[model samples]
Target: MCSSVNAELLVDKQTFTSQNFKTFNGNNIKEVNVGWESYGNLNPQKDNVILITHYFTGNSHAAGKYDVADASLGYWDAIIGPGKAIDTNRFFVISVDSLANLGVGDPHVITTGPASINPDTQKPYGLDFPVVTIRDFVNVQKLVLESLGIQKLYAVVGPSMGSMQAIDWAAAYPSKVERMMSVIGAGQSDPWTTALLEHWATPIKLDRNWNDGDYYAGSAPIDGLTASLMLITQNALSADFFNQLGKQTVPFQALESEPLHDIRKSHSIVNWLRSRAQARATTMDANHLLYLVRACQLFITGHQHDFSKAIASITAKTLFLPATQDQLLMPYHAKQTHQALIDSGKKSQIKMLEGPLGHLEGVTGISQHTDAIRAFLKQ
Candidate 1:
């Protein structure tokens, strides 16, 4: 495991909401704070820039960190080194933390979710952070990049939720990006992913200890949150991988197998679950999760929500890579998006990653596609 890295404070910038646009749910507009990070040095031209968007649980620490077990190379360190796929020797890499990334112990991390202080009440926002969408995420990223004097990217690369942002960058700001890569992600969050996420959120909400999202003053819904996390990890693994382990069948040799009823007896399971969940939970407002989820549910391309128009808006060279064993996002999602890109008269390609790590293949052990990724960026 990478050692925990110390938090490095980035920018703490504010943004206003779109005056002409209302949320899909027709909620009042609101501004937000965006926190982010950068790597390498921008050349005199500022054209050799690469943008990396993170997954749902990822933060601005793309490389390693100080106090936290942040890897020096970062989450995709394997592919972003001096001579690696991103080739830092040639390009300046920039990665920004999303509006609600659940980063911990990182002072430079900024979010509009639960941990943020409510401007009005002067207290933590908790569940009060307004809902945000992929557009919102992309808009904030634009702000971060522009602040750095970067006007265009040689490429924008990311996986899963980050991929959504990458695709959105191409769609919402076509001329700003020369290329895009979306790995283990889709143009829209499918029902399957959303349905399962609901299960994960339930435990956080049902924890009687959860005082309607006001658990900060005292104990949070640690127990319920852990339970939900356990479910998510188990489900995130693909059936093909689980079948090899035969998770359904207990091992014939068992040192200890007892029926324990109390939550304390099951504390080990909860602990393991919480450990994973907490890594991804960050300080997000539970309400922010709802709003983000709702925003995903409202995803539709074009003004009519027709994906044809959405896919057509891509003006950059695009690559969509999905893991074959990803039971969560599934390869079909990338294929659908790829096909839409073709239908929209866009230059795009889909390459399926072959691996057993499941959805995580996009993160862990993904160097197998590093050469291909490098080639795409070279163009």
Candidate 2:
């Protein structure tokens, strides 16, 4: 089992704010505040630092419980701690919440998004927040590192949306990062992936209650938000996994209903998905989710026009770990990026993770590749 130095780590949330921040699109945000958390100690030279970015729905809590009584550990608690794969015992693992983070309502997450109040107008930013990109996430992280006097990174790593940030870090600051890893992710959002992301936001937009992203004063677009989450949950899984779900709950009840009178009825699996999304929606904001979707869709290494030139600038030894069954960010995304890195003569290697959970395997099945990660880090 993965364990922290103190048995179960009791971590605290810390805040980092950047003033007069300029976004990749030439937009200016007066202030950007994001929560961060750290595991292990920063060595004197600060060279032992390893930055781990969080996924789309995740916050900065990457490896510990916020309190002793907490019911669950961080999502990746399985392979990040004292003696685990990333091995916090010898390296300082740090993670920061990205601007437009989906978990904006979680008390543990400090992020500036559409849900945040604009100091100038004393109202929620709504759709007014500047369009932030993965490069902006990298820049915010860089500011945090500079604040702590950390100049060199031992490794920059993450999965899903986090992976995009990891790749951007290596490409943007080639001299500062030593190693990089992208799990269930790619270097850029291709045309296909970008189009697919639009579906996640469509349900929310279709909700009349959304009121064009200005629903903060009244009822939230719960139905739309729930549908969006359901789609995300489904897309993140494979047909192999989907078939196994709701096995005990009959496959179809709507079809068997008396007189076939209702078109609103759904299958057990649909209800199951809605229930899961409802549980998660309680602490989430609809606008924040929309912003995150846009941020993900706009991702590209170095945030430049020349994708080739940007990726070619990376000097960090790279490792790409793609899930064999992922349908969301398919394995080919990682393969394509890895091949480019190898062609450029950069240290790059690819590994496959196996599990039924699909894209989520990158989080739940990370432990299976402990040896591979340990070996890569050592190299």
Candidate 3:
């Protein structure tokens, strides 16, 4: 039962342009306006801010309640409340929407990306929008912070894609954040992860309806999107979960009894796959997804191209919490980040949570980590 506040609008809600908005590969410049939401009071000192970044489909809603009045409460309602991990009572939380979000469905969400208004023909930019990087996402965040009169952050936090943004914040503006936590995420995207992500994009690309990503009026690649999500869930879950929950000894008759597509659709594929895919498809811009994937592929921590250097550059008190059973981003990635920070002479903590639920444990069921996050935020 998270509630909403009627505070004066913080961001002016307009388009922004920047010549320095370069792509991850340093290819070209772009303009961006990162949409966001803020909660709690920004004390006169302006140091009591807590930044919350969202995952792939997550938006400005991070806590108590505030996306659409009819929609369910914030995705992390259990952890973000008056006295929960985020503690709205003590900290003002600010969550941001990434560039090229399709959530704001008006005008077809032509954001700065491979799809945006050309400004020349007044038509959809369609591939004209410059590519955006994670660093670019952080830059827009800086703009929002500056505009709102916030000079520093008490902490920056999130899980999954949000975690990447959190890490970038600490690395890019070490002086601004005092603490940073990344859950179920890695400092850099590994090839295995990238390969899987490419698969996710494949269905969309191969579908005839994709139409070179210019399919505005024609049918969308819903089937391909659905199939890709089905694959994603299988890869993301842990063996323990299936062993416990799946039919261990289905009758030979049952195997023959169940319809093929029905069986496929029934394997939590509804809750786990369809829900996530539809959630992502509705809000994420097709081209923006490409931009984000490329940005993830470009993730490096240090020495211009080394992840270790990127990890070493982080000066904020770091906490890397990855689930022990996570298959997508695996626990080893968290351990790797933690070890890198420690080896860099930074006192970072690496604690793993044991869960049968793999990567999803960081989201759908995150109570244990919520407690850990509470303790961290308190400090």
Give each model's whole-structure lDDT: 0.69, 0.89, 0.67
Model 3 TM-score, 2 decimals? 0.83
Candidate 2, superposed: residue stretches over 4 Å from native: 1-6, 248-261
Instruction: Put down candidate 2 lDDT per residue, 1-379, tens digits, no spaces.
Output: 1235457777889999889999888999998999999988888888999999989988888888988789999888887888888888899989999898887778989999899989899999999988788888999999999999999899999999999999999999999999999999988899999999999999999999999999888999989999999999999998878877645554644355632666776666777889999999999989988988998998888888888888799999999999999999999999999999888878899999999999999988888888999999899
RMSD per model, one decimal: 5.1, 2.2, 4.5
Taking all chains together, each candidate's TM-score versus the true structure is: 0.82, 0.96, 0.83
lDDT of 3 by residue, 1-379 (tens): 1234552122212333444455554655444555565566677788889888777645666555333443455566677656677777677778767776535443322235555555566666656666666776777777778877888889988787778888888888888889998888788778887886787667767888777777655676666656565666666678787665544432222344235446543433235446666665654456555556666666654316666667677789888878888888888777888888888999788778677888877776666777778888777
TM-score of 1: 0.82
Clashes found in each candidate (C-alpha, N, C closer than 3 A): 19, 0, 7
lDDT of 2 at 69: 81
